[model samples]
Target: MGTDETTGAEPRATLEGFLRARRDRVRPEDVGLPGSGRRRVPGLRREEVAILAGVSTDYYMRLEQGRERNPSPQVLDALARALLLDGEATDHLHRLALAGGRRSRGAARPERVNPHLLRLLDRWSDTPAFVLGGTLDVVARNRLAAALHADFTVTDNLARMTFLDPAARGFHRDWDRSAAAVVAELHKAAGARADDPRLSALVGELSLRSTDFRTLWARHDVRGKSGGAKRLHHSAVGPLDLHYESFTVNNADGHGQQLVVYQAEPGSPSEEALALLGSLHTLYPENGPEAGAGTRTGRA
Candidate 1:
């Protein structure tokens, strides 16, 4: 019942919040349960979920109220099945259950990109690559990556850029999909780091500023960053269809870092545009069209 210092608001318990939001998404028909006409709430009732999970209604109610902690693996599995969660969402549910009300003790150390990774990024002159910290902060980027994101006013955090920057709507061709994916990634991060102050602050800022962010966040979607195709409209290069692969950087310190690289199909128009962009970057290293125009400092 403690208040969140970061947001100065009463914070919802992680497990309870997740359970409620997810429960609201599942319809009675989703689990082969016949519809009981005219329910006040969306999705299945607590009794319905308990029935599906093979647990007592009281126990399930306690679980949703944050009074019941330390659910066994068997119970967790049953709940996952009852909720019809996918692999990622199931894993996230387990993580939240295992967290056991942990809280952040102090400020986290600033994230730094590995020197070898930086060298690798620089070597891929034709590709766009960048390193992202746990909270999707762009810790480091190669010249090509910088050029790829030249339209962004703040290139620090992907979530911030997607939700807070005006250029994002134009830059991301599928704005709705991009926005949902960004929020879903953040949702996954929040499950792992429930009490992380920086993350809480970021979520609070986005929730306050963007209606779209609030709507997506409320869905409680969980997804990790992985290989995917992106359709982007660059200010200089027009539309560019690219595939990106994300690799985890296994640092000695065990910090969460991901190296993301973007590539275009060979002989495609996107590839030609990318090559043109690289040439432009090389021609004007500091003050050319590739330069990050209207760049501004962002929150760490």
Candidate 2:
């Protein structure tokens, strides 16, 4: 999403943007609207969306134009259905509508990692584990986890590394999928803590630096924490396949802090790779080398 030329600032993400983006992605044929020839807009027309949502054309148009901020729950539900929004997308729509069309841009309190959690991460010698802050900032990481993500110039911020770091594109075997996932997670975080200045700044920086980030951010996809397998190519250990599980730390000093742990199956090649990574990690600590060293400070 580009900025308003008049303002010379990135347009604040609004409910209107969300609606327009989603609407642009849907087609008339997909929603049972009769195909039209040479339409000016990309997706279904505003009138078609209004019809599908059982609302007046003027009312729906107002919603998209930002003339109307809040929409009733019934209207939102109808719009969600009309747009064929998935559970995550539908939830995000509700959040945006209830938020009065704009993400909170207020300053947020600082986050601190719990010492006990750090100790726990340390105890997981074989497994790769790290704690992430609200905006997916790497709050803390164990030795193995540090080694696992050693390729990136800055491992402190996952979103930054995924978009800004060239090594990240090659490090993540499924580069496109990983990029989308990071943006979706960031969207979910923004919905919950939009007022956080750190999050806002991170979004602004990425929106400006990377066109890819802008394109994906405009998609408004929201995703929650869940375990999944990943394929990563490490320079030292070659390719490795591992599964990770994420756990939320409730009432932690940091908002939306999550603990992510990566593991490989026993007797597998990935397991051997993990062992090698651990051995190498002990010899070359994450903080020793300038090139491989990652920042401990919070960037978001």
With a 3 Å backbone cut-off (N, CA, C), the pairs that clash in candidate 2 are: none
RMSD of each: 4.1, 3.7
- Whole-model lDDT values for every prediction: 0.79, 0.79
* Candidate 1 RMSD computed on C-alpha atoms after optimal superposition onto the true structure: 4.1
Ten contiguous residues with the weakest lDDT in model 1: 287-296
TM-score of each: 0.90, 0.89
Model 2 worst lDDT window (10 residues): 286-295
Q: For model 1, what is the error of residue 17's alpha carbon versus the real structure, in angstroms, after optimal superposition?
A: 0.8
